[model samples]
Target: MAKLSPKNLHCELVVTVDEKINPHIMRDRNTGQIYADDDYLYRLKLRSEKRVIECDGLRYLDHSLTVDEEGNQELVLRGSCPSGERTEVEVVHRFSIPVRGRYIEERITIVNCGKDRYYLEDMRFGFRRGLCPAYEPGQLADDISRFRLVAVPYRKVGISQDKGSPSPGARPSVKRQEYTMEDMIEGKFSNVDWRNDETVVGQDLVDRYRLRSEGWAWTDGRCGLLIVKYNDEMIEYSLVERNGYSRRECLVFGGAGFALYREPRPASVLEPQTKVSFGPTRYIFFDGGWKKAFYLFRDFMAEKGHGLPDGYNPPVNWNVLYDIGWYHSDREKLFKHYNLEALHREARKARDLGCELLYLDPGWEVCEGTTLWDEERLGRVEDLVRTLKEEFGLELGYRTIGRVYRDEFPNEWYIQRSKEKGQYIRPIGSDGKPIGFWEPCTECREWWEEKLRRILGITGEGVKFMMFDEFDWRGPCFNPSHGHPVPSTPEGHVRAVYRLIEEVRRRCPEVLV
Candidate 1:
């Protein structure tokens, strides 16, 4: 038994052992609020020799406080793997509560001690702590109703819910989806992962309330528990699923576990003799509602260099899409309202309306996703930028997408999904046209280099803003010649996107992406 009593923090974290070391509770000293209860630390699953082994029900070994490289005190808890498995694995849970900080940072380091190559199936780095005691089935307590699970899913980040609205605030991506603890207790959730367009068989059969979110907060207006994980990969966590109507009401981090939506198994592997760390997940105990959690998330992100630059004052953009309308790759309709002359009229309107930038949506390019400026239709890119600035008094900006309106690129450069089966490329659109509208695999070196070159060319012409939109993961790209892993993982897709953005910034640091 041990208590982590950080002097600067308002709460004390208590760890206890009952076969395993459980980070049992975190209690707020000032308000006398019990923020956490019934907390177990971690769970891991591995596959070897066609046999599945679970590293849960861990046996407690010892714990100690040590100074990290940055001089922060970290509480390290050591544990032994269960005696049942033939293979040996060592797991350690490290937690740090920085001085004068409101959050506890946690991570689990797993070291495979055996010789066999182990495939990591599932790893719950942090355990869910119950907010309230167990209640009878179908019964909801008033206190429980006060507690809401607030989550900000990754997809909603940086995107405005309403496209036509004014410039979004700093926390535009912060979605305050408040589902009361009572909601989960009462079993309120969709049968499928419809939110992400994924459906699975017998998913609803288990009454687990699963939600996809980068981080979440369990709050009751006055006090809250915030959990956030910041990783390079475009991955999220599910901390809201409570299994099968049981009264264990804690939100488990690996409750539903990590896997591609609708995939039968995990795509992660742990080679022998390698050490893997699962998190640096922040566990914050704060005062006030779920918004406080969001503020902390923002602050943490800023610390990670994800925030705006010191002097970033983005111009108020007047998007011409509202007036010009999406031409949908129809040359006839596009020329009618989306030509350079029409855009000049819109720029005049933007200048008169006090807008600082005239944002082109979809028609400036020869075709959507080509990233080629239609010099014949819109004149030269540099000339247009000078005109937009000198004549209209507005900076130039445009949107770019990964999906092509037509198949200009080689068929091999496009996305190839296994689900497409024998079909080599995407079929024609429902309109019986070869809009061959599939996203080019960004991981393809040739496509990546070409896209980078095109974007750099546009930015070089004094384009101030470039919005890289619709570059989401369509699925694993199965093209063998692409040089990426066969059935490329979501992480690979995300890294490729990041690489593109980073390279763009490296070349054109002044342009806002």
Candidate 2:
């Protein structure tokens, strides 16, 4: 067992590691509490329900903090699970609890070591039992009655208009939820992806409805367990709070939600010699109640070593993404007679409402595909920026469905152009045509140049902030043209986007993405 107390960490952790065995049950010093621990460390069924992985039986080989190219150190643990056959599969787990930070984040990776091809149905990393559920004088049982909060970034309810060029027809009113336990448990609740219906949970919702990248928070009112999920990939987590095993309050079991699906959306295959992993589900144990959970999560995010947003502080300064229509334009509201005036009013309204910035989404583009502002149809971007800042004294922000729109300007211009510079493009299709208009290959040189130019251009034009929405870029570009393997992947795409965003900061050091 090895203990780690990263610098300035208000807390310390004890990890139980043994040769030929994965680390289990890491307890904190204050509460003697354990999370993502060994009690049920390797809980997912690998091939089938009967073939669940027994990590305690697996062989632990190495654990170290490897320095990434940027010279930052990362904690990584490696182990192997025997298939009860010829080849041994390697399991790589990367994790860390930052100095004085409140979360224990560990990503999952399974590599095929042997020559035999592997097929895995589902894999869940953490079993969600016994994770900081406390009891008090309340009549409710501690386990079943403890609170669980799920943060829905955007839950559309009805039609609505928001700060934008105003397309009322396109904007849907979002019913942002303050979810109680019932609302979450009743939703399509399977956190694990494969063979979901096979479990006691019936087919509750479609694949999209599953809501993989959910922000899950659990607390017994004293200490709390909040998992900040950043993507809809392998980091998905399940939260069940109902009458079940162990706890009279409720049994809240969760594992890493990152599972691979086959027919609809696919999870990565555990083929021999291939590698796949995702974690870093940020969690925190703060000194407060459920009311402050969201606030706490936001503060801890900057500390998780992921880059912080511009002026990344909390009571997160306020933006307009979730309160109303996700910044979509209502064509009727946007191009109408009161277009510019309406924007002026909205900007003033946001300012008066105490918002620091007004977020405009999906409307100002000349067409859905073009990044150029629709000056002719919706007035000049320069005028809008001046009004928002000069008149309203609020920062100007904007976003599009994806960075590059396909409706007008095909991705080909950037794709072909970038490719000429030995850059890569993410073809929207398996057809290999480099014609994915809706999706830009961030790996391509054009993507980087255009983003930098666009950021600087918009910032220079008085825009201070941006969200490259709909950039849920697909992984590890299989485009060998992108300098990756022939079989491109989601990871590659993610890295490319990260690089571009970093470049955006370097060039427009003041602009926020």
User: How many clashes in each structure?
Assistant: 0, 40
Alpha-carbon TM-score of each model against the true structure: 0.81, 0.51
Candidate 1 lDDT, 203-297, residue by residue in tens: 22122345656678777888877777765533545455654313555545532255334221222566778766654677777889877878877
Cα RMSD, model 1: 5.5
CA lDDT of each prediction against the hidden true structure: 0.69, 0.50
Clashing pairs in 1: none
* Candidate 2 residue lDDT tens string, 1-513: 554333123333334456554444444455544443333345333552234454334556777765455433357777776455533567777766554455666566677776555555444455434322234213433343455454432222343343346564564545533454544444434333322112112233333333343455555566666666554443343433332223322333343543223211234356656776554555566555555676765565555655555767422134443333332334554466335555566666687777877776656665453566767665777777776678777777777444443433334423332223443344433344544344455666555566556556655676677676566543323334445444444455566667766776676666677
